[model samples]
Target: MLRGLTTVSHFSDDVPAAVAWYAELLGIEPYFQREVQGKLAYVEFRLGDYQHELGILDRRFAPPGAGTPGGTMTYWAVDDVEATYQRLLDLGGTAQQSPTEHGPGFVTASVIDPFGNQLGVMFNQHYLDVFTGRPA
Candidate 1:
């Protein structure tokens, strides 16, 4: 049995810049930020829709090899894929894949954050309707 994702943590060389970038893109200010072991380090933001807390951690304090971005990327469902992609680009995010239709009514795009983590934005009205048993 699975519950739900609680948090997604990312490592960054510059914590302040990473936090600011994410805050601007996600439109959510950090709910918590604190120093750990006498060093100003971790920052976490609670995103809209209660998805999960996004964390920006100082890579110097991260465990061995933990600073590297994993093979798997994280995706956030958005109502407007194009608008969000543009916003990300404007906020210094690098576009890895331009918005594309994945299937009937499903669109997706990928962008790399300042710290090299891949973030994806997806829109799928058809899939949503099917999942919720409603007309699209």
Candidate 2:
């Protein structure tokens, strides 16, 4: 059985710094964290509809030779593509793709966070309408 996305996780060498950076970007603190013996192990932020989660894991868990801006990419919804794109860049996230409108109101952009993971942002009309009962 396959379930849809419940969480999206990113890796970072520094948990606290990654937490701070993501908190600033998302404008909210993580709602849950995994810690063992009082040491940070993981942090998760719930955002968007379905409480879709974005998690930050300590990079120690990554396989050897892993690097930032990895192969996988996941796009989160954003209301304003241009402003959000600029904001991520301003926050030290390197640009991977500038915002581009695909077709019929679907737009997207991507960036590599300071920690080297790809972060995607999209203004997806269909997804927004289905979730919110209003067109994007």
lDDT of 2 by residue, 12-49 (tens): 98889999999999899999989866779799999987
Show how many residue pairs clash in every candidate, following the order shown. 0, 2
Best by TM-score: 2
Q: How far is 88's C-alpha from truth in model 2 (Å)?
A: 0.4
Point out where model 2 deviates above 4 Å.
Answer: 63-67, 134-136
Show the colliding residue pairs in model 2: 68-116, 69-116
Candidate 1's TM-score reads: 0.81
TM-score of 2: 0.89
lDDT of 2: 0.88
Top model by lDDT, which number?
2
TM-score per candidate: 0.81, 0.89
Model 1: lDDT equals 0.80
lDDT of 1 at 110: 83
